[model samples]
Target: MSLPFNVQRAQDRMGIEDPMADDPGLFHLSRTERLMAFGACFVIGLALSIIGSALVFTGHLAVFAVCYSLGNVVSLLGMCFLVGFKKHLKMAMAPVRLTAFIVYIAFLALTFVSAFAFDIAALCIVFAICQYCALAWYSASYIPYGRKIIKSTCGTFAKSI
Candidate 1:
């Protein structure tokens, strides 16, 4: 099946090739199937995250941390369905994304440590916020000029302040 015009255009602009264009060896899936898998994983991850957030009211910090972290990880893994796992890892470890990736992973781990080991709710919250910011930064790195735009906007806001 043909891709939508916008999606095809964006893929062209980004120099992205269809994962199924070449034989992927094992676990092959058509574009539509891959999209379905990605969508399913993303929705499941979002549900887990929402459930974790709701658990916060019950004061189950450890469970919240575990669920939230797992949710984020699962969501991230969903990208592998669109791009192969090796390609995803290569892009993640690229120089542009390295810092954001490190910070994101660090915060993810720190959130768990603070919640389960240290039993520090405040610290866990702080780490969770950092993890989210890092994840956003990492995601924005994928778009053309996205990081530059964000930096410039933040700089302008800082100057105004």
Candidate 2:
């Protein structure tokens, strides 16, 4: 069976345009939108770290904590690189961010379930779901704005950094 929702419907419901309407690779966003996206990601990272710390302090779920840390490291590095190329990455940013979001959420869910009390874990899962979706959407929207810059730099900017 097909899903009940599609990207277009979601955008329409949220009062946003088809972020790729003009040049499939150019999504323009406001400053507030960009800040909100980054903030949401930061919150998710903080929450995961807190949960990881809890697991470490209790001397339990060591395996889960290890996995969480590994995933966080990969995601953080990707984000850092993406941010450095944000003015140039263009169409590719959408898929890169989407992949990071999915992998991080999966690791987050597994970590939360294995590390915390049922009640607290459920709350964290719910909050993470909402925040991640917002982060993914905004990240996707902002990515297109970097197309021109990335194309010109050809990654030399990232190399220098």
Candidate 3:
């Protein structure tokens, strides 16, 4: 007895609700907010890649290779986290941030090797200062939590666990 168009209209009306009905949380950034956050990350990555490429163009092959490799490793880790965690920022921070920091330090130290091997001390120093600053900012923003756990007791011993 009901027209198909009327039934469709009823279904559509039933689906409407307040977009902000849910409380906002770390994982609940609106689409525009998410886009802006992602854009900032992308711009930083692009700038770092460009600096690495500039090293290549200026004949610092060893430095360029080290920078390039570090970038690739970090990017790959991020991609893996995004895929496995479905973009859950907190999940990515818990383990991957520490892993990425360790990897970054290892590769950053390798840049010193390139500096010594190629005798590009000044250039490497400048690059290191910039890279460290950028990384500190990145870490602060993305991994706000530090390694902290409540105290725990095991059979006969107690410690901060």
**Which structure among the candidates has the greatest TM-score?**
1
TM-score of 3: 0.33
**Candidates' TM-scores?**
0.82, 0.29, 0.33
Q: Give me the runs in candidate 1 sitting further than 4 Å from their true place.
A: 1-26, 152-161
Model 1 lDDT tens row, 1-161: 56789988998999987654544423677778778888998998888888988887789999999888888888888887777677778889999899899999999999999998999888888898888778878988877798889899999999999
Task: Estimate candidate 2's alpha-carbon lDDT, on a 0 to 1 scale.
Answer: 0.48
Candidate no. 1 TM-score:
0.82
Write the residue-wise lDDT of candidate 3 on 13-107 in tens digits: 88743222333434566545544555555555556666776887687766565665466435434332222334434433566465645545654
> What C-alpha lDDT do the candidate models reach, one value each?
0.84, 0.48, 0.51
Best by lDDT: 1
Instruction: List model 2 lDDT by residue over 1-161, tens digit each.
Output: 11237866887788864422332122343334444544665666666656755665455555435434543544443443323334334433466565545555565565456445443444454544544444454344455655445445757876788
For model 3, the run of ten residues with the poorest summed lDDT = 147-156
Cα distance off (Å), candidate 1, residue 104:
1.0
Record all residue pairs in model 2 with backbone atoms less than 3 Å apart, i.e. clashing. 88-149, 88-150
* C-alpha RMSD between model 1 and the true structure: 3.1
So what's the TM-score on candidate 2? Answer: 0.29
